[model samples]
Target: MQRDRNQIIQAENSLLASYAVRQDETGVREYPEAEHPYRIPLQRDRDRVVHSSAFKRLQYKTQVFVYSVGENYRNRLTHTLEVAGISRTMATALGLNSLLAETIALAHDLGHTPFGHAGQDMLSDLMKDFGGFEHNKQSLRIVTFLETRYPSFPGLNLCGETIKGMMKHGGEYLGSHLGQERKEEGPSLEAQCADVADEIAYTSHDIDDGLEMGYLKLEELSDLHLWSDSFLKVKEEYPDLGGKVLVRSVIRELTNGMVSNMIRTIESRIHQWKISSRADLNFHFQEGKRIATYEPEYWEKVRELKSFLYRTLYRHPSVVVTSDRGRDIIESLFYHFRKQPDSIPETYRQRFETEGLERCVCDFVAGMTDRYAEEMAQSIGFKSKEA
Candidate 1:
């Protein structure tokens, strides 16, 4: 077919909805450069993200269980991949930019500190006196500042749309301090897809992992409306289904049900709100309304499932013990680096001079893998199996 960039962009524009973010309308990169000859802006942005060092580091970063917990649990990288896959499916079904959604989903967790949310929480508390630490902001920082790829730019020089997607992948604008123009509204349809996909991926996979680890029991989860419904459907389909097979079927059905509901609800909202254009969507968002959401009943089910996970799995004593140990390791590493800024790698030491001690230390700590963090902590006499 030999479609050039313009032709590919035109094809995409023709297929996408008016409310979908178009490649042609995307804002330029911070460091302006010539476009790729073959791939469109969003495609190139996705490639850059996939090829980045931070993206690779996600392999060893924690998602729920720490890396040392077991090989069977989902790590940060696997979670990101699942989110991207789900985002692409949702975006395609919604007639939005699937590539953009996938890019955002992949880059969404790039800033997550080692040891999952526990490490991030610890760092956030430590950096409260500074500007505060957040994975959303850190992801932006990695793409725009920390990752020095090309000689002309400090970051990957991704398109503004991709950066915006990353910033708003949580369904809200966290904050942008890189001098980029801030959006007054919520994320675009693609970003919103990525956001929901992140939720779907984690909720389902966490359930799978929890069950595998014996932290959560299927009998207990049956009380949740979402779980009960899926379980009943799977049981009805295969009356003899039992054990892991039944669990897998239920989880698959659960994810499928959520995705189907999300798509249907979004379509209904688009029609109800008369959102025929991107401007309409933006206006609704500016008015503090979401165009992308599940129906009320489905949303309630989601909430119930979340609450159950939090109560039974996330706050379980075993999980809490590991989380607390991770927190202590993060804190120890932060103070150690803060006191000896020169002890950081030369690359980061140079950043310390410009980004200040706290910011540099935070970046260095945030970039570490779970095993690396543990090793660093153990080097300084912190005693623990993981540390």
Candidate 2:
């Protein structure tokens, strides 16, 4: 027996919470199309995001360490997968739309530039006189305007709900250019899950990467309450465990603790806010109350951990050197393309007539991976290849 789209949606609705965004409630897109027989709208949207060219480019983009740093370090693609896995787990535990959460997680970093945050910061500074650059807005641009998968539409033309989830994945909406209706309220619970999942995945994985790369010693993190508590528990269980095994166990425990706390806190918030339905969630959101969050105490700990990572791992001399080099490459590429607009591919060149030279150049440079950006910089004589 083959269950059609409606049947699948019905099953999904039955399993999800009242406050979860239903497939039937999605807004219409710029290009309307028929739904697939076997796939729900959100599922199709997830597939479209997975298949996008920008999604593929994520494999080579940096999460912290550049691609040339080592194959074992987390790149954008691995980070996206980690976020998706964590998001789906939280969404399922919270009785929200797991597929939407996963889709948003997968698409959230689709706009990240070549050397992680460093590349993004440089690009933003370069484009400051223009419209400025933000990865969230760039991710939206990739799905809505840049990706050319369909002959009928300019982009993937994903469901409105999925796009909404992506726009609000960071717990805030910055797509004011998307018009008034898209700026109605805070993100849905699914988007909230994805946002927290991003935080969890990066916080845990960056520590793992730092430890492996020798930038962060295990003893150094022993002082942080979150790490100390998790480390104590893991050590209790595996007394003989040391090295990578011990580190991995502690990271696992830390992530698990955070996810469990987030779920518990959100459940309490839902009850406190009287949010029994999606409408109620939206009402509370529009009223300037957030229904999804970690407990205040735990959130403070997370902030402390983040500060530690920023000082120790992110600002470590080796990482700083790479980031500085990456910034130089991005700046060089931006100026090179800005001067010789025709040097860019015809596809981007055509966009210059509509988006202006700087904006078009920004788009072209932003889409490049670490290796591509470095190679382009060398080719343009902006820097030596060995440099």
Candidate 3:
């Protein structure tokens, strides 16, 4: 005997907390369609995101290092997967909708430009007059108007909740593209899980990548409370641990510790706020209360770690040079297509009439992988031998 969609949804909802968004509230798509026979809306949304071209292109998009930096470094795709996994664990532990959390995590970075933040910063600077570039908003644009798979819909036609979460991912919601209905409710706990998962994934993995690249050393991280605490615990557990294996274990422990801390914090907050239902959560948000957070001291430590990474790893001379080259490639490509609109693909050129030439070009360039961007740059005589 197999359970149908209705039965499955009931069974799943039975386990969720009152504050969790119900599967039924996955909300409507921009374009209406028949529901799947077995899959709930959030699950269906996750499948659609997985199948999107933007998700696939994350393979070649940068996270912290250029794709050419090393095969071992985390690319955008890997980071997204890590975030999704962590979010599922956290959401499930908190009795929230794990599928919704995972879906948001997977789709969160869909709009990241090639070459990571470097590409995005350059694009933002160039588009300042037209409308500024934000990866979060770009992601919303991709799902809403850019992707052209369905005959009737221009974008993925994702659930309104998913779209809202994307825009709310990094506080980029400016009431520009989405309607008031979608923007009224604050971010769900599932969305909060994705946000924290993203931070945990990047912080831990950057440590791993930084160590691997010889850009960061264990000795340097000793002063950071998060690292130092996790390191000591790992060392105490495995006194004989040494070298790469030890470092990997420490990173794993760090990630685990952060997830556990978040779980505890959320649980504490729920009880303290007396949040028993969706309405309660919404009321809290309306009152300017936020749920997803670390304890004050822990958050300060996390902030300290972030500051350390920004100064020591992200701004390292080698990483900066590599990121600079990527910026140059994007800059050259942007101007090249702007000067010669015909140079962009015929599909994008068609969008120029409605989307405007600058936006159309921005979309085309934003969707490029590091490798493809370099190829486009080389075609126009922008030369660079470095990664």
Candidate 4:
């Protein structure tokens, strides 16, 4: 269905991704039964993620606090839901591809290790000799191959478009040492839209979470750089909007500024970097290709917000100490069970014994819950409540 102007991003020319998850019309139609009763193509993407074992395990995965003695803190699952909400809202307003945006947001952290980035870093260090470890690529693996829904397909069989967008964070993928020449090029408009939405969601929500956790005060946050510019004007204009209002106002500004850059870059055609449209994701013009850059001041605002979170929310004493412990728990769990393999879960054991150990170990650690982490730790004598 063609989206209305106010709804999803509509492109008369928006081509489909290089592949699709359930592309075979005949196969989807005859897959043992029935029709999907949804209007959006990504609804299937959403359903698949929701039903997956990995998604359920997100309840134990850390966003900030890990090994929480209580259920009050935000887990990776809650964070993903928040990101989806904000991403959908921003995409709706910008007329970006909301379904694709939501899909990327939903799958962004599926590959995250047991303790989040801390866990990721440890695994990356351990797997340096291998292909290296990254949550984004892991998300793709989970959806496409690891999920056990279909016998014939190795993964959940997601289409190409959503997978592409989920991995392509910017117009490109910038990691450890990959320079301008070799970095995987940027994302489609759909993927780019999701990236922007992720920023908007996490920045605001993390601040809110920090305040709730007593790691930050509202007054202290007002000192952050985002308010140094036109914030007063926006506040006066939308006095009753509160945090929700402030978040939308700030996001709208950032998005508009960024989109303006994208338009200008595309039109000027002095492209130094390649941005993928429907036709090409990695094609760079030697003469007329460039990446979009936002205003420095605007960038400062974003940096300050991120820095504030790094200091007060993510790096806060409570958040850090707990996640540090969480790292030990996951690593210990992985090392111990990875040897026996069969002690973890029947499916995981079979997968490990069959598919090789690393991925199976990934699957086992990825499936644990918060309590399960503690329980495993206690059982292994790595941790004891009495300690």
Q: What is the C-alpha RMSD of each candidate to the true structure, in Å?
A: 2.2, 2.1, 1.9, 6.7
Residue-level lDDT of model 2, residues 258-332, one tens digit each, is: 999999999998888778987787788787777567789988989999999999999999888889989999998
C-alpha lDDT score of every prediction, in listed order: 0.88, 0.87, 0.89, 0.61
Report the lDDT tens digits of candidate 1 across residue range 288-328. 78867899988999999999999988899988888999999
Between which residue pairs do clashes occur in model 1? Answer: none
* Top-TM-score candidate index: 3
Q: Where in model 1 is the C-alpha error above 4 Å? A: 169-182, 384-387
Better of 3 and 4 by TM-score: 3
- Please say which candidate is ahead in lDDT: 1 or 4: 1
TM-score, structure 3 vs. true: 0.96
- Write the number of the candidate with greater lDDT, choosing between 2 and 3: 3
What is the TM-score of each predicted model, taking all chains together?
0.95, 0.95, 0.96, 0.72
Model 3 worst lDDT window (10 residues): 169-178
Residue 172's lDDT within candidate 4 is: 38
Candidate 2: what lDDT? 0.87
Kindly report the root-mean-square deviation of model 1 from the true structure over all alpha carbons: 2.2
Indicate whether candidate 1 or candidate 2 has the larger lDDT.
1
Among all windows of ten consecutive residues in candidate 4, which has the lowest summed lDDT?
Answer: 20-29
